[model samples]
Target: MGSTMIEKILARSSGSDSVSAGDIVFARPHRILSHDNSAAILGIFEKLGGKKVWASDRIFIALDHAVPPPDEKKAKNHTMIREFVARQGIRHFYEGGTGICHQVLPEYGHVKPGVVIFGSDSHTTTHGAFGAAGIPIGRTETASVWALGETWLKVPESFRIELSGEAPRGVVAKDIILYIIGKVSADGATYKAVEFHGAGVENMDISGRMTICNMAAEMGAKAGMVPFDKVTEEWLSGAGVKEYDPLYPDDDALYEKKMEIDLAGITPQVARPHKVDNVVPVSELEETVIDVALLGTCTNGRLEDLRQAVEILDGRRIKSGVRLLVYPASRKEMQQADKEGLIGKLLQSGAQIAVPACGPCLGAYGGVLAPGENCISTANRNFKGRMGCREDTGVYLASPATVAASALEGRIVSPYI
Candidate 1:
């Protein structure tokens, strides 16, 4: 009879005492998130016959995803988004070089615990690390929320994934998650609110938790959440969040499914071309050649990831003829790295530090691969054409340490090796 975290949050937003799986509720979100695609969303808002947003203060826009106007087209789109923000009186707008919207939003305290957040990007689930419900919606749904202030949500069944044991040397949150996704396959938790639990999850810093929840969408999960605890509290407090309502599932809450993963057995994992679940241990593919090694994304571009990569590089330049691209997730992260001299270290290691945005992750701009080339990256997905936009080009998903180690070796090598 107890409620899951999603159920409780939805019920509160719906002004109800309780909600169950399969129940439909109209919930008002604490934040409405959109990125560079806001231009399309703005057009939809106008088609809905909207002049002004229902709640300008609740709307947050960012010019990420194709930042720096890769072309005249993207530049024009950015122009429209800026004009739209000014016209609508939206308060939280971040321009290019400001970092990805997810990182910028949290850096500025836009995410608060126990609140519902709906975004136009699938990785909206990243906010769940802070104890919020982050659900991805389409562009039209975004415009509707802008005009109407509320939207419908079908309460999802819950899945509890329990993690145990400490990760071994050179293994990290990314490898652990890759191993889980490989075990469960792509459609494992479709439409379910996946809650992460146990010591393995609790041991991670806020950055690692964000990476876990950000990639939940890869598993077809509606949302992925880590329980709010001291880690969450400390991070939020540092981010200037003074008050929040953190929600936790009841001890006896019912779940549709459960899974357990022991991190001790996990190692550097790689999700091969065309599928994030097409994973195998790095040891299995030591000779896999790579043309590029990417070291950042919203999924793993935080300071922790950058530090780990720098540690592996350890004053060693990457292999000749291989390109190493290092992208920090946000301006804040970029600045911190500069202060700590990590940026200099990476640059000396033959890494090219790009702007703080979704660079090369979506194949929009930055370092796109040539035909028949392969890249080993610290990104979330490895779907076909995800990075290079060509069937012949391939991408391998791995942790920062693995990517760095492979960059030095010019092949898919384990960091531990």
Candidate 2:
């Protein structure tokens, strides 16, 4: 009979005493997020007859996709965005190389518990790691949020997923989520708020939680969150975030569905080409050869993820048939890796290091696959032509450790050793 955290957050943002699944309410978001797509959104904003944004301070613009401007068109887009930012006096614009929008937004203390945010990118659900509801909206919707500061949302049915038990060694947040998606299927939780609960999620680091939440969209979740806890507090404190009202679900909160997963049963998992939900255990794909290993993205591109990959490589070089591309999610993560000597080791191991941009995660450039080449990547999606413009190429999704291990062997392999 109690409200779920998503319900509560929705109620608070909408200034409503109470809300339930299916209730449409106009909610004012604490922040608005857009990346390179801001170019398109700003155009829509102008088309909507907007002169200035609702609040310059609340808007976050980060140039990530096609960053460093892959072409003259994109370069002009960046130039236009810069001029628009100056004209609108938007205060939170992040230039190219700062990092992915999701990574840098929280680094700047923008994401907080109980706040509501809407980003133009699907991975906006990533912010739910901090116990805030981060929803993805379309470009037109993003433009509307920029102009109106608020948008209407239908409260989604909530599901409670309790994760317990310790995972096997080499198993990580990415593999676990992949396992869940494989079990639940792609559209399993469509338009539903998913709350990650129990010991497993609670024990995970903020980076791990971000990885889990970042992929929630793959399962069609409207929001994916873990309640705020000490881990959350510590990370935010490091980011200089002092005050936030952490919201928790009522003990008897009603859920549309409830399930429990034992992490002990999980293993390094992979999603084969063409779809995120087409997953299987890595053991099943031992002989699968790989031509590339991509080890970074918003999903698994953090200092912890980089460290995981480096730990697997361990003073070894990747095999001949494999070209390894390691992209830091942000400059902060890259700097931390550099400070810890992770970068030097990777270079010595022959892994190619790229900037903190999205980097072919959506095939925006920096690293793209050729026909007949297959890549094992830490990125979230592996849709056809996702990592390359050529549909003849293929992509396989895995954790950082798995990607690195596969790179070392020139084949799809688990991180068991």
Which consecutive 10 residues in model 1 have the weakest lDDT in total? 382-391
Summarize candidate 2's per-residue lDDT along 39-103 as a digit string, tens digits. Answer: 88999999999998999999999999987887899999999999999999999999999999999
lDDT of each model, Cα atoms only?
A: 0.91, 0.92
The alpha-carbon root-mean-square deviation between model 2 and the true structure, to one decimal in Å, is 0.8
**Quality of model 2 by C-alpha lDDT:** 0.92
**TM-scores, in order shown?**
0.99, 0.99
Residues 197-276 of candidate 1 have per-residue lDDT tens digits of: 99999999999999889988889999999889999999989899988888899999999998999999998999999899
Candidate 2: where is the Cα deviation over 4 Å? none
Model 2 residue 276 lDDT score:
91
Off by over 4 Å in 1: none
